[model samples]
Target chain A: MILDSIQRVLSTNELVTAFLFVGTLVWLSYLISARLTRGQVHGSAIAIALGLVLAWYGGLVTGGNRGLADISFFAGVGTLGGAMFRDFAIVATAFGADIKALKQAGFVGAVSIVIGVFVSFLIGGIVAISFGYTDPIAVTTIGAGAATYIVGPVTGTALGAGSDVIALSVAAGLTKSVLVMIGTPFIAPKIGLNNPHSALIYGGLMGTTSGVAGGLAATDPKLVPYGAMTATFYTGVGCLLAPSVLYLGVRALL
Target chain B: MVIYGVALLSFCMLTGVLVGDLLGEVMGVQSNVGGVGIAMLLLLVLSNLDSRKLKLTPITEKGIGFWSAMYIPIVVAMAARQNVFSALSGGWMAIVAGVAAVAASFALIPVLARFGKGEHQ
Candidate 1:
């Protein structure tokens, strides 16, 4: 009777179960991070990677949308991983810095945004070409996505690219964001990303605000504002450039 | 006091989302634009309002501190929800494009740093 009751309670409280599940995943990831990677790779990065693996497996097994959240028991994963909490966490991280420090990197931040957008666009565009995506719209959309996830759809919609190509653009940008978040802490020392100015440049160059913000938060919370500020500008600059000057540039080349 | 911190964050988030949605509508995009970024800015501005009367208590500061460090779990959950496998299965082009773009951008950091004036380290 007690066993049946426990099962009923566990099954009913989905969100609680989700917390328990994600908590354990995080615990296991930290253990692996400490023993295997010797703490060189942050626990958060490992946790995210493991979560992605679980998501892939969940998709394979269920063959349903919403990833692991599709399973009844894991149904709460959808709400737990939804945008509301994501934005809440991001806002929490933003509380760690000072606005006064943001003023120190003005000119460098602007230059980084322009150069960052162009470089990412060039690299993404070149790769798209090499991969046989010869259409200017496809190349431009993906190239803008390489700038940031936000810019990708904005560019795609503005250019009237097909839905599939726009989806690809979003995926490309999401991949970039995850990569930046996971790679930041490991590369911080080598890149001299220890200051506000460098953080500003890094933010602009990286262009994805969430990626830069998360990466900087992991590496040094104090630098989040500087990096996030320029990264924000990067998206605006990308949206302006991608569908116009950048798209025209691609057309000229193609 | 802790409740106040949560209240402050909630207020910033609501305002940010509204502004982000408005901006998206203005820009003709169908999604909220820069909501989190705006929320962060709001928190920064509100917390540092430079008024002696408005200064946060230590308990409220601690409350904010607690939530700030809890971003890891949220990030993990967000990662779990992304359908990366399907996205990758679309083709090798998407993977190559993303990885190359981030890699090339990373490589340019030092060069850009040199041109950006003093690091003030």
Candidate 2:
């Protein structure tokens, strides 16, 4: 009787339940990571890792594209994680930044974005070529993902690329960002990631806003704004350059 | 006053979307162009307008702070759900590129550090 009632409840409001399910998993992941890793890893990173694992398992079980969402009760995971909330959160980040501090990064920060984008693009393009994805759109989509996850979809959507390719681009970007998030704290001292300017340059070269933000938050909460500032600019510049100049250049090459 | 602050935040977002729409039309792209970026720029500018004139309070700033940070965890979880599954199903290229990008960036750090040539201490 109790199980039947619970099933009915889940059936009626599955999406909210999915949010609750995700929230619990994320909370649990954070707790484990904090205890096990002594906070060497960000809870967000750990939660993301757990999320991916669960998603893979969900797909393996159901043999469906939507992962856990392939199961009825968990269908809300798809909507909860969809583009609607994604854009809402992206725009929400606007109010959190300080403009004055961004200028502190100066010329080095400015130059870093250009170099970072090119280098990441080149690396991603080369990797795509090796994978036998010879199409210009495929290469460019993945290359833009190397620039930033946000840039990947924006470029892919604009260019009318395949959903699978766009998804691949997003994954590629996510992997880069997660690694940066986990690796930044360990590498900080060795790379001289102390001052606001260095933080800015770090953000520029790294070019993943959330990674830089979470990583800086762990390393030194004071530097979050500085690093995030240039990282924010990196995404904007990446978006601007990728579709036009970068795509045209890739087309020229191929 | 805090409610007014959120209202102002929404206003900034609306204006940003409009501007992004215009830019998209100009650029001949089907998608929105930099709405989030423009909104953030507006917010940065609006933050300076907190004054005795607007009757700004700590509460107003706190409200903005509260909601702004709320997005990060959700965004991370969302990305994990979307990206990982896609990368897995889309073949090994995404994973390979992701690993390669991370590796290449790490390799470039020493070079960037040398070229940057800034003081560690």
Candidate 3:
């Protein structure tokens, strides 16, 4: 009777249950990060990879557009994973920072964000055209994806790009995340990525929050927040530019 | 005290969304642009000010910290929503585009590092 009541409660309060589910997943991911990767790969990156796999599997099982949220038990994940909460988390991360430390990054950090978005978009756009994706929307979406996964989808959705193109953008962003996660430590010493200023600039340039956070964690745990803060800003800047200024530029070029 | 933090966060969030929507309209895009970013800026500015004048209590700080720590798990939830299979099947172009972008970005880090030197003090 107690078990039945517990089950009933969980099913009814789906949002709380979803939180529990995601919490468990994050816990498991951290365990894997600790044991398997020995913390070279950050837990956030692992959690992301695992989430993607689970999403893929959930789709196969349910054949739904909402990914894992299609399952009734996971239904509340739709809201939890939606833009509202995503924004909330992003904002909270900024709240966790010390601004006095941020100002220390100064002009270089600011410049890096603009340069980072532009360079990534330029490279992504060129590659897309080389691949024969001439549609301005496709090129722009893919290029934005290079900026970050969030930027890609946000740009794609804003521009009303096709699903296939959007999917490609997501894939591209994911690849970038994995790369940064694996590559940060290897390159840290050579680039002088030791200080808070460099980390802030690095975050702006790299722009993938999970990637930069994971990479920085492996490099120096103290630097994760600095990198993550700028990375979050990078996402915002990319979203602001990709669909508007960048799209116009790509259209003109094509 | 915790309720105050929640109220402050909510206030920032709502205002951020409004501004983002306006930005989208100005830019000719149909979606909210950078609302989360704006919200973060607001929270940062507000909390910084709070530290100086209002001095939020530890309990409120704890509330904000609780939400802040949710960053990783929330992002995991966000990750779950992405359709990786469709993207993988979309084409090798996706892989190429992504790898190339990151590779180029990685290469430029040292060069970018050069411009910001001497400011670290």
Candidate 4:
């Protein structure tokens, strides 16, 4: 009976590697941060490291399958990359010594995010229909990821699309990271969104939205805690609903 | 300086992903390898960060903004998958979800803040 239970446990572990992968990476990141930096390393750096390791192991364990490894590798890297760039942009704005300007930039950023979400969803929906793919999970995962450029993996997971979700998530994250890295600094100044407070608002919203998406996409109730923790720590609560809004908006049109 | 930071971070992140993928392909170690790699990198980066003077004031507000922008897409993607909008047969469901999340944050953040302050006190 004990052997049977152990077998069951091992099977369960193999079946649900997602949670394990994420959890292990996070824990490892913390351990590294604490041990190497004496706890001074930035959380973003830890996240980046965790992502890289996950991608590497994900590939090797999956048996030299590039496609298989790509999902986790991309998701982890894209997420860390996005966060890092966003943080850098905000830090730059904060160093500019202009509170009023920052506030304006923040408001503009908030508005732009709202618009970006809407537009991305529209495009994603069209892609789903055009491809003749009706797998709700795939459609939603790919569509959402392609549109908003974040939280695609979580949505993919919730939809039961497996590693593909991670792949889509990575794709979306890359898009957003690239855009924000290139666009925010140049546009914020013109639009007066360069103040530190504004950067805070923008960053908070982004973090919150990612958290909410992750929570909604979670299949296991246990993941909810991790999702919430990620949401709260990585993103602000304000952006949590962004995923749902975009999803439904597109679904409605369809 | 910010651009440089962004570039460096991006490069490190990209390198981490590529290395993780390569290692996984060669050894079949899986995502666990990526996790391990990240742990190693964090240890190295942290060691470097520890020697620098850490300042929270100017970066705090900016940090908040940066996180907010980055997170927006993530939430939007989640909502899209929830099909809450599809089940409800309207866009209002999405709006409701979004509002609820925001409301929950407002309710929860202050409590968290208080708890954090209490710890210090």
On TM-score, the candidate that comes out on top is 1
Superior candidate under lDDT, 2 versus 3: 3
Docking quality level of the chain pair in candidate 1: medium
Query: Per-residue lDDT tens digits of candidate 3, residues A1-254?
Result: 99889878877998998899999998998999899989877776677667767777777778775667777778777778776776665566666577777776667887888999998888888888998889999999999998888889999998999988888888788777756755777788878888877787788888987677556655665676567666766877788889999999888888
Q: Using alpha carbons, what is the TM-score of model 1?
A: 0.86
Count residue pairs with overlapping backbones in model 1. 0
Ranking by TM-score: 1, 3, 2, 4
Please list all clashing residue pairs in model 2, or write none if there are none. Answer: none
Q: Where does model 3 exceed 4 Å of error?
A: A1-10, A37-41, A133-141, A148-195, A206-254, B50-53, B119-121
lDDT of 4 by residue, B1-121 (tens): 3344443434444565466456545643222123222322432343234444532333443433343344323222222122121112213322232333233322332333233235444
Assess the local accuracy of residue A96 in candidate 1 as a C-alpha lDDT between 0 and 100. 61
Q: Model 1 over residues A1-254: C-alpha lDDT tens digits? A: 99888777866897788788889989998899899989977777688778777777777778764567766677777777776776676677678675655666677778888999999888888888887899999999999888877788899998899999888888788778767877888888888889877888898899886577557755776776677666765776788789989999999988
Chain A fold similarity by TM-score, each prediction: 0.82, 0.67, 0.70, 0.41
DockQ of each: 0.57, 0.42, 0.51, 0.03
Q: Give the DockQ-based CAPRI class for model 3.
A: medium
Candidate 4 second chain TM: 0.38
Q: Give the interface RMSD values of the models in order.
A: 2.7, 4.2, 3.4, 16.2
How close is each model in CA RMSD to the real structure?
3.0, 4.4, 4.0, 19.1
iRMS, model 2 (angstroms): 4.2
Put down candidate 2 lDDT per residue, A70-168, tens digits, no spaces: 767777777666555544555555565556555544566678877777788888888988888888998999999987888899889989999988888
What lDDT would candidate 1 get against the real structure?
A: 0.78
